[model samples]
Target: MEKKVQQYYKLKQKQKEIEKELAGLREEIIAYCSSQDSSDAELGSYKVKLVVQNRKEYDDAKLYETLSDPEVWRLLSRADPAKVASLVKLNVISDERIHHTYTLKTVTLLQVDKK
Candidate 1:
């Protein structure tokens, strides 16, 4: 267990170092793309495409107070049929837009010794 814990910490440190390097490279790539006015570029045989995504989020409190109604619910219901599945499970009354797909999960290392 001790050995696995040590290995996990060591690997995590290395992962952070790689993540920093990756962030730096991403910035450089974006810089190059902006300078060349290109959304995509060829790197040897691989194509590097820069994608930018945007979303609109509203305050849950405001949504609960003024926005959420039978009309807005009907609109979202038609636009996203599957969304209602998860929202139905939630106990909240706010029908405000949220980032349901963008979820962060912690990856913990657990080791069990054979009895």
Candidate 2:
């Protein structure tokens, strides 16, 4: 009877540990999903452009194509929002001279939750 009691206590302890681990994993998953969702929203419609003087004799301009939603989400999931915003600002500054560069601005469309 004593042996059985000890076994039961051990099992309960193990169960508690497992439950704690599961809870931690659940939180991590939730965080990951939230980040992915944010990224998906950001990448849905984004663009950037560059304007620079080439050879100091001619003005050269370049446009960086926006990534697809999936790609943008994948990237945003791993990127910091502040960093992304900073890059966008930098691009805007660099391309300020070019009128078309305004079109290259990044626009984050908010996702509406459907009930």
RMSD of each: 12.5, 19.0
List candidate 2 stretches off by more than 4 Å. 38-115
1-115 in candidate 2: lDDT tens per residue?
9999999999999999999997776556445546665333322343222222222111122222332345443544433434444445766323233333223333332232332
Candidate achieving the largest lDDT: 1
The local distance difference test score of model 1 is: 0.55
Per-residue lDDT of model 1, residues 25-45, tens digit only:
777877777689877677665
Backbone clash total for model 2 is 0
The lDDT, on a scale of 0 to 1, for candidate 2 is 0.44
Superposed by TM-score, candidate 1 places the C-alpha of residue 22 at a distance from the truth, in angstroms, of 0.6
Candidate 1: list runs displaced more than 4 Å.
Answer: 67-115
The lDDT of each candidate is: 0.55, 0.44
